[model samples]
Target: MTHPPTTAIRHSPDLEGELRAASKVTLIGMVLDAVLGIIKVIGGVFFHSQALLVDGIHSFSDVASDLVVLGVMRVSRQKPDQNHPYGHQRIETIGTMVLGSILIAVGAALAWDNILRLIQGGADQVPGWPVLVAAAASVIGKEWIYRYTRRVGQAIRSDLIIANAWHSRTDAFSSVIVLVSTLGAMGGFIWIDTLAAVVIAGIIIHIGWKFTWDAVKELVDTGLSPEDTEMLKAIARDTEGVRNVHELRSRRMGHDILLDIHLVVRPEISVSEGHQIGMQVVSGMRDALDNIRDINFHIDAENDEEHPPTSEQLPSREGIRNLLDEHLGGLPSHTRIRLHYLRNKIHVELFFESPDDAPGLDAEQITRHLQGYPWFGSLRLWFGAR
Candidate 1:
């Protein structure tokens, strides 16, 4: 785990630029939702249209939900630090939870209002065509918004935006239903509009619950689906020097994935060599699934006792960092220092592959011995080995 720094790597400038563009699209979505919600509500009321009101209420919540998504996106862009070593990407998931809750609240509130209207015989009013036309306009506009957001979300692999994109489309869906009811009510059947409102309320409730439960699952660190797990396995197997990929664990933290795996290499290979192989494996995986931001790949010797000696093959400390990076979820070793005072003290910070199936030898005992070197001073260490 305690290794030195390696060479530098660069990010794709085009990709970075595209991601920034995505943020702007999300902001536009938030503004549109708010404006559309207000227009529908005012128009619906003026025309005595239940369907229009239902659509308006549904769109209204979209504004709040999009605002939540934008907030999450803002937090997620922050760089990783001590407090959030894994970065703030998962904050997007928390945002999703809040958005879901808001949806449910608004949907339930509208449903309650509909119930009140039914109880008070509010369905007796005949809905007007003007309001129905407004609902149709809203439906078309929101559907366009959904299309734009969805394209951006998919290209960037943003789950929050994707979910919100569908949410907007749901508003459109409700508006379409409202349009139908308003047209039906022109035939002197007022209950048609009332029934449509009730149905629209049901749809909103269902969508809200879906988002709520999904976000809750992510917050709890739910495992990746079977499909993705298999895909990762295939990725590891195809990598050079990886004998097998085992203990492949995956968890969804918001839109990002935290994955860990054990890559078995030839036993007797130096720890540094094994780590190099692990890094290669991780690189392959990233290419396979661009959505993955964190990956922990533990390198293990295959048939250690039967393999040849690896002591002479190990690379120097300078090269160890690159070799061991895969174990730290692709993060390079932080810092390695040698303090020469009355005694030799090696202060190194590092991360190791800590998985249940591939637990390495004791880490604490090695730190104590390493600190006993001739230049040992104050020992600062973050020890992890696999």
Candidate 2:
């Protein structure tokens, strides 16, 4: 007998709560980013500060990314459809990629513009007190947002929320750079402001690249970390009645994981018993790993490497029943028969009801009666009836 794979089901309450939390935080981030961007742009133009102007560009990028997060979260929260049986989680990953790539482009553009100004020696002009004030206010505001978003994100374990919080924190760092450079330029170190733009651009580029690489890896169906895989395997092997675990595999879809593995059990167990053991393994693993969304468990009666199914030549259930009727007619009808196909033959087990006594034919006598059949390997009689 061949056992098929089992697929695990995901509960929706956690997912729904995550979506709600992410939406609320991202929306708040969008408002804060928009306000900060407008303030910095106006102040930079008024005070002639190159660093503050580019810092505004960074804040604007945050606004755009927050919008991307919002759009992706909406789609990703949708239930699984006919076209996408795995649900819409991957869309969130693609959204992250889009945001990252856009940030890279924006960073490159800002860097190039500022580098040209420095090469032409046109960025030597000093900024006024208003530019420094705007940068200071931005630093405070962005830091506050970052801390709040990070707290909520970690509580819910939402990648999107956490990523956006990092984005905000990066903006705060850029504002700090702007503040320092503005002060240096006012003190007659005129090139410091232009250099600040380049540094801010580098930070933006690095953050963008990290987000893009992580999303790309997920899109390629990368497995869980080796440590997590080891933990999951240990859980499976510890399951009662599970002799061993093999061929463990895992993949991610957003925050959830999908697993595929084989559980080995005693060769003599009935099919129903094997199924129960597989279920137990699944339950234990689910309790250990909260992110597991589904599992495809394949039950194996023996080490498949040692005993291939195609090599087995065994009597069918009907053939075994007919043999018993023809040769052992006095056996009670209520007796249960179990056949274990192993070593290219059938190992038979007869189970009797409570208070039932042993049959007249012993194991050796039954084996002798079926001696002419090449498919009969061994026989056992179990008389303790329960």
Best by lDDT: 2
Q: What TM-score would you give candidate 1 relative to the actual structure?
A: 0.67
TM-score of each: 0.67, 0.83
Candidate 2 per-residue lDDT over residues 249-319, each given as its tens digit: 89988767888888887776666787788788778888888778878788876776666663534567887
Clashing residue pairs for model 1: 295-329, 343-375, 343-376, 344-374, 344-375, 344-376, 345-375, 345-376
Candidate 1: what lDDT? 0.65
Per-residue lDDT of model 1, residues 229-315, tens digit only:
998899888888778765687887656677877666664355577667777877877887776767776665442334432343334
Candidate 1 residue 117 Cα shift, in angstroms, is 5.5
Error of 1 at 379 (Å): 34
In angstroms, what RMSD does candidate 1 have relative to the true structure?
Answer: 13.3
Q: For candidate 2, list the clashing residue pairs, or say none.
A: 8-294, 8-295
Task: Give candidate 2's error at residue 376 in angstroms.
Answer: 4.1
